[model samples]
Target: MLTQLSLPKLQIPFLCHGQFMVRVLVVSQAVAVVLAFAPGVYGDVWARLGFISVFVHWISIITTLCLCAARHKINQLKPISIISVVLCIFLTLTLIVSAVAFSLFSTLFNSINHEMSDFLAKNLMVAFIVALVAVQFLIVHAEKSEQLNAQTHAELNALQARIQPHFLFNTLNTVAELTHIDADAAEKSLLALSALFRAALDVGKLVPLQTELELAKQYLSLEQWRLGRRMNVNWQIPDALPAIQIPALTIQPLLENAIRYGIENSAEVGKLNIFSIESRNALTIVITNPYYQSIKSSGGNGIALDNIRQRLMLQYGSSASLTFGNSEGLYRVKLVIPKS
Candidate 1:
């Protein structure tokens, strides 16, 4: 049921300024109509202006909606530019017919003359043109936004792909190291290694929180087997937080980094703490490991930390954060994911 939802579809948040501008234009037009055309309410320029303004606003909105809908349909065809041009011609014809009908209805049954009707028709035509311009501007703006998002996604996928090889190299080396000392352990490690690689290959760049955490557990199990008593793994995650989604292998790679750095640097066994915090709107995963001061001071390895940051940015843009620093004697990685 959850898989059917396709919840990862990307969308842009609506801007208040854009909505405000549309509202202002709509309100200004409505007010102008009330002032100008109100029968016997005002006997000045305000009345005439109001009459024309309201009419202009109404006509503009209708024409714009028509053009926008037609443009959207045309977009489903071949070239959008060609479709837009054709749609504009159709818009002109629609406006002409509407203006003629409005003028005939107003003049034949009322006090307005042909001269006034002609002026009204001209105003309607101008409104249609204004509406067309607005729709075109909106289309251009939407397309630019989509292109930028596409570029960001492409950069992120490239980053994810680059980070995969480093982990593969490490795992293969571990498998090689364990082969001779304990034949049975090495065979089990190989099986776990195969499962880990298969999961990594089959899973998408992003997955449900439950799926990622499951993968993380499998990964940790394999590492623990390889590291033997030299690695200590501790997990503290509530059951409620499993519903929140995250990038696949996001936590695992960070854990791998911690393990690699901690175990390699420590003369004795090193402890790793993997925990999650579920707040109202965010689910944060913290991976902490004890490291020697020398390893902590050496700083980034250009693999796990940077890779995770790039993936989060690609998936959540500015909405998610990945941070690393030393607190007390432990080096820690904290990934803050927005609650899905």
Candidate 2:
């Protein structure tokens, strides 16, 4: 049996955004200027402009407040329902404001006279047309935004998926090597591997920094078990890790790269160092390992680094960064995560 797929529901723009309100105010003022100069028998154009501006500003402010108030409910409505609801609010407010303006205009500006019915009809018509266009534009913009978000989510998941298999295969190979050498150690490695996988597989867009660090520790323990004295890791983490969220599986892959490229390819004991520098707005993690020039690294391809970079961009936009290079005979990777 085939089932129909459900498309994403339409989302309303946040009407309370400062930029949006500013645009509304500017457009309303422009409209007022145009209306005031519409070839009328006006003695004073400035007076007409002032009157129209006041009227339009009143309508704009009231409409904005009404929409902002009903935004939560309006967002839950279907496309047609949302359009209908917004139009009703706009037309209703415009009519009321138009009536008030007409009464005041007749009393104050005796030179210009507009019948109540004509004024109300004209205001309602304009409100309906403007509201319709605005609603359609907002809906289209939201739909495109939703589609872009969906595409990004799919790409993020694909990148995340790519990382797991590489991690699993590498960890399993290490466990296999350990089993032949020592059974009890292999059992402990399996336990650690289980904990690592649970964190990796069940992770969402972000996890606590502490959790990611723990996962990295588990992975490094498995590697230490396999490599023994060949690999020595020095941790310089703070006693109190910052309460921040980081992308999952971030640190482990960097450590894996260090082990694969820096440690395993070397004959002498390799040194790996992990440390953190904390500031008010950002946390920086630095990983450094020996870079051997003569000995060619067997697995030097940068799949993990590239994957981590893409994931960081998706999560943090441009605020967070991952950078690495060889500095003074040592390869260094630095990851910076913003507190925001």
Candidate 3:
């Protein structure tokens, strides 16, 4: 669904402020209309050319700029309906002003009686086509700008929401217990907790793949300390990790899910596996954990997974993906990122 945001005339967003693109649209449209008026039946050849050159560029550029300004409202209409109505309205306004100016200026400067009806007859259809092209360009550009803004806003909110309260409380409890027995270890745990929270708050930006993997490792280490031998992690990362870029804290939530579903609920020690495979075109990271069958399953939709997918779409378009599957008694997730 489209947003109900409204915009007023003459207020263009920064994305629509490409003056070079606007001028190019104006000049090309102006030349096309001028050529259509070459076989002049009006008074003076040079005067007709000069008047059209001025009028065509003026009308086309203003109409396009104004369309961009009003895009939020205009985009609500259906595609064909918008194109038809926009062309009709702009063409009508353009012809009315051009016809009146033609008569007034010809009479004043050329001292000849030229009819407004003749001017309208000469330029109406050609001006309509030019207006159509200009309006379409602005409409497409404005719509894309709006979409990108909406996605960015959602991604920011997701970043702020991803701070897990349960993780914080559990880690603090572990810190309190460790403080009494092993003061130095407790101090290290407190520092780790603080670092993780700081990283959580500053996500939604890009970082190298190794940095993201390190964050996941930090999180797992803390969880293992709290859970003792019940939580086990096996990392199969390469000595030379890929230098690819990904969103910061991208893998942390997945690790949290692993602990929640696989380790926390189990009576026996549960194992979590982290491994990756790389190819020339893409890299795939696989996470697997033992899922005991005795516990009754609770159904809940995954907000973290949805958030990651949306962020991936915004950053990599269709080049990245997240998928889930199960084999034997183990659950698995695979994340694929393009090398490009």
Candidate 4:
């Protein structure tokens, strides 16, 4: 849970939801057509349509600017009240622009004042009713998207809270086992353990790849006090590692699983190999080890893998992955993270 939920939450600002500019353009174009024909007692239908198009786009731009300016205060209002306020503003703009539109229409076509007045009044009312529906559609759609993201975050936080205690208990066991045989190493392990507690339990955000790698190294060092040379690690990394960010404890659990299932079960001194591949847009980490198929725990990778997958989903959605499988003569686990 810490691995996934610690990643950033999806955010949509109140007035800056997706495709807002495009929605404004499309609604303005649509309303222009309908308003042009609403005044049936008009000459040259094409001329009237052209005239309305100008103010339709004009009104849309002004209304959008006003809403964006007041977005901070408006977001605090109740949903029903928000709708009422939006319509009131739309109606107010319509009333304000009506006289200007009437004068222009009369001048352009030499229409009588009475006819132009009727046309402007009827069209502005039509614009209000149409614009109200369009505005509400955009607001409701954005609200639903934000709500879904919020629920996902809540679930991840709850999962992180529950799993952290289990992880702490397991770490304490490793320290307890080291006390009798090697007091000096146990003391060092306690020091390393303190860092792990801060990195894991009090996670503020994803750490750099180098930072995560060192933590993994510390974990393996602590384990070696008990396992000795049996826990062999071959780290194949570039001289200058890429600046990649990953969730805390992202690679540590995988190493623990390797020791328990691959290293511990092997009759010969077990070897583990870890390396990285940096591409233009992604970082891929591969961990390979020798294992006995017969000794594999049926539920070996369940919780840890689930946790990693969850974290990836939270951070990168479906783009990032944790894939593990045994093939040929080696068991391989590959993790892919997007650079973005």
Candidate 3 weakest lDDT stretch, 10 residues: 6-15
In candidate 1, position 56 carries an lDDT of 54
For residues 1-340, could you state the per-residue lDDT of candidate 3 as single tens digits? Answer: 2223432111122223355556556686658455746564556666656665666666666666666566556545765545656777678768766766775676655623556676676568667666657655756655774576477657556544544667788898998899899898888787778778777666767788987887787788788889999988999979686678887767887788778867887778888999999998679999988765422253221566667777776566567898875678787888988665
Which candidate tops TM-score? Answer: 3
Error of 4 at 308 (Å): 0.4
Ranking by TM-score: 3, 2, 1, 4
lDDT of 3 at 115: 67
Q: How close is candidate 1 to the true structure, as a TM-score?
A: 0.54
Give lDDT tens digits, candidate 2, residues 1-340.
2112232355555465566788889999998988888875466788878888999999998999888788768877876677778889989999999888888786777545768998788878888888978876866776775665566556547755765676678778888988899888889889998988787675434789988898888888988887889999999998697788787778887887787778887788899999999998789999999876632344333666766776676555566789988877688999998775
Q: What order do candidates take by lDDT, descending?
A: 2, 4, 3, 1
What lDDT does candidate 3 reach at residue 274? 91
Q: What's the C-alpha lDDT at position 269 in model 1?
A: 78
Model 2 RMSD, rounded to 1 decimal: 7.6
Clashing pairs in 1: 32-50, 33-50, 36-47, 36-50, 36-51, 37-51
TM-score of each: 0.54, 0.56, 0.56, 0.54
The weakest ten consecutive residues by lDDT in model 1 span: 7-16
